[model samples]
Target: MSEIQTVPESRRFLSALGPGLAGALSVTLIHEGARRVLSHPPRMDVLGKRSLKKGLRWFGVRPSHGRRLHRQALVGDIISNSLFYALVALGRPRRPYLRGVLLGTLAGVGAVLLPPFLGLGRSPRRAKRSTALLTVAWYLLGGLSAARATRTV
Candidate 1:
């Protein structure tokens, strides 16, 4: 008779947790790098007019647009974090990095669209800050849960 090998549930859970941590850390590093670049406040003319326009479009808006788009980006970051944590909680591991990027992008768009669509045209700074804080909190929670999962295995 052939024996059936069964993996322990704890091991399976921990394996899933590993990828989630990797994804979260990747996001945090990317975010910090982007912040560092922004802090330098690159000159508009140094990059040239055409390149500058392209960059603004890629980032989803012009510099003259104020912090509205920036706030959306922050909200997107929070949404991405939430998605990562939700995946971890479900023990699902498939394209974590890509998923993070997609979720982040969607969140950014949502932040831009939601307020104006709902006719709540106030500054988005407060909402952005709140979202960023929530993201950090979610990351902390995910880390703790992953740690516990590791210990169990």
Candidate 2:
């Protein structure tokens, strides 16, 4: 008789990490690279930076400025995005691309709409139309990357 073998929970989680990190990296790269060329770039990292600063202030910790702030914000963004994308491991959806689109849309909408409600101020939706669109588009790109990685990796 053959005994059944099950994968450990931690191993399952680790399996998702590679695809998740790939997606997060893609999103960051697309946004940062675009910032140099766009006259009115969507400032998602700025939003993250501001949120981080507020969190630090709440804890009475002094936040860094300029380049340091940017680095911290980018790190935070990547880590958070990685975890978010890693949720795919739980579902193991048959259609990963669709899952990617749905997940990305949800995140993009939240990014555009949640800021004002959270006292984070105006969202990308309040900015120029292009900014709003690009904000969503980059997220979609990340989702696609993650979904593709899920299939291949």
User: Which tens-of-lDDT digit does each residue in 53-110 have in candidate 1?
Assistant: 4556779975433355444444454444444543543433434444444444543444
Question: Cα lDDT of model 2 overall?
Answer: 0.85
lDDT of 2 by residue, 52-72 (tens): 998899999999999999999
| Per-residue lDDT value at 135 in model 1 | 38
Q: Lowest lDDT 10-mer window, candidate 1?
A: 40-49
Q: Candidate 1: misplaced stretches above 4 Å?
A: 39-153
Pairs that collide in candidate 2 are: none
